[model samples]
Target: MATVLGSVRAFFAQSAYSIDQENPGDVVARERLLDRAMGEARFRNSSEKLRRGRVPADGLALVARDPDGYVIGTVRLWNVEAGVDASGNAVPALLLGPLAVDPEHEGKGIGSALMRAAVTEAATRGHGAVLLVGDAPYYERFGFFADKAKHLVMPGPSERDRFLALELKQGWLGGAAGVLVPSGRRFGRAGLRKAA
Candidate 1:
């Protein structure tokens, strides 16, 4: 009986949180969590230039929820052209950013979990590469390296070293060059037009 009880406790403890697709209802909460984790500086980030007025790639936005079902983490990927290749053909890639976890939930693996989920899903969806501007030490473990993105540049000013990438398919980014541009769907202004 004690063994069975211990198993149940372990299961519950491990299940204290869950990762899932971000639903419509999670937007506000996700935004709040991002604000808390990243503060106002997140808006001025160079990556925002590519992400602004754009929607995340289909089904690439994700959220982490705590035991009480509150959103504690968020990560999203946007489609971007990794510049034209040697043959001048546009090389497509995904830009990851604003990966934020609630301040209170720091050190609980929520950010890492969200990252792994996002990258795995992007690969499963057949994306060729993933890029982001982040701390080297934290992202290096996920195969994101500066050398891979050395030839590429963000739309706005960004530290060279902070830009990193992981090619989902080997050599997917090889020969890719030029400024990254937004290739994802934009938030249509139809609603705004109607409001006007």
Candidate 2:
């Protein structure tokens, strides 16, 4: 199903906008797009607990630009410990969230393009899994599921059914069980250069 959707998305992507690594100048636009898509409620979501003070994972922050050189979409993935409480194993997983598209650009496939980039990049860099709090109807098409994530928990309150996980490698979340936490390296924008 995921593959089928990916192909369908690809078919529509023939004339897709350009996706690139987000730069310093892209922050404001990214923030606006996020606000428009999720409103202030986004800052209070469970995933924000992990991303609060930490920087986005290296090579995982991206923006989609329109033909006019405008940033129309944004998505970022952060680092977190998959089993911070129960096992204290320090197992790493990328947390994807705040994936937003301009209101007028919603049906253009910009959001899914960013998702594909995020998951593919994480796997290429050897990360195990990707986690997020989003609608199953939307995210499941990207291969994220609650079945594997049922064994894990989030730091703050989150709708159990909305917490989803996708293993980049086969069985990446097989033994992962515990609370997700801000387990990634400490890095703000200034410290981003230090992350691998």
Candidate 3:
């Protein structure tokens, strides 16, 4: 009876250890995860559109990795500016999007972690705001909203509700309003620099 109880305790201890080893704190480590998560469909579609001499290379790319070192999610930002706002300020903003999480890991907080990291980085780099086209409910949790309606617009048609922005600093979008051009010159030298 004593031996059986000891063995049971050992089994339980090993199980706990295994679980701990499997769930290390989420971290962003590399760009490969973004490439892999983008996959062919994502690459051919959204990525291709953004990469077409438009998106800036200087923008940021981030990923969330699990304890096993597997990339579970990703987000990217691009250099952009908004038209003059009510205050007559030319608001330079960052376009945020293409946030994706592994299907198997969708509900595990990986997406949120990636978003938090990107937002923090953008703020640290002195960006005014981060914009995106996504669900209001999901993004709202991260302080994204439609407050830029008066001064923000996308180059192509986009649902008004889906268009959103988050200010990293107070009055970041003051006096800015206009079409959001892809960070590059639609593919010129500046564009090349952005895509680099």
Winning candidate number (TM-score): 1
| Candidate with best lDDT | 1
Q: Relative to the true structure, how large is the alpha-carbon lDDT of every model?
A: 0.84, 0.80, 0.61
The digit string of per-residue lDDT tens for model 1 on 86-191 reads 9999999999988999999889877887788888888878899999999999999999999999899999998899999999999988999999999988776652
Ordered by TM-score, highest first, the candidates read 1, 2, 3
Q: What is the per-residue lDDT of model 2 for residues 1-196, given as tens digits with 9 covering 90 to 100?
A: 1222334335445565777778877878888888888899988878888888787887778788876668899888898888843455677888998789999899978898889877877777788899999899999999999997988899999999999999998888888888888766676656565332
RMSD after Cα superposition, model 1: 7.1
Query: 186, model 3: CA deviation in Å?
Result: 8.7
Root-mean-square deviation of Cα positions for candidate 2 versus the true structure, in angstroms: 4.8
Instruction: List clash counts for every candidate, in order.
Output: 0, 0, 11
Off by over 4 Å in 2: 1-16, 84-88, 192-196
Error of 2 at 191 (Å): 1.7
User: Worst ten-residue run, lDDT, model 1?
Assistant: 1-10
- Between candidates 1 and 3, name the one with more favorable TM-score: 1
lDDT of 3 by residue, 24-100 (tens): 13223323444555555555443235445564324355555555555566666777756666766566777886887
TM-score for each of the candidates: 0.89, 0.87, 0.67
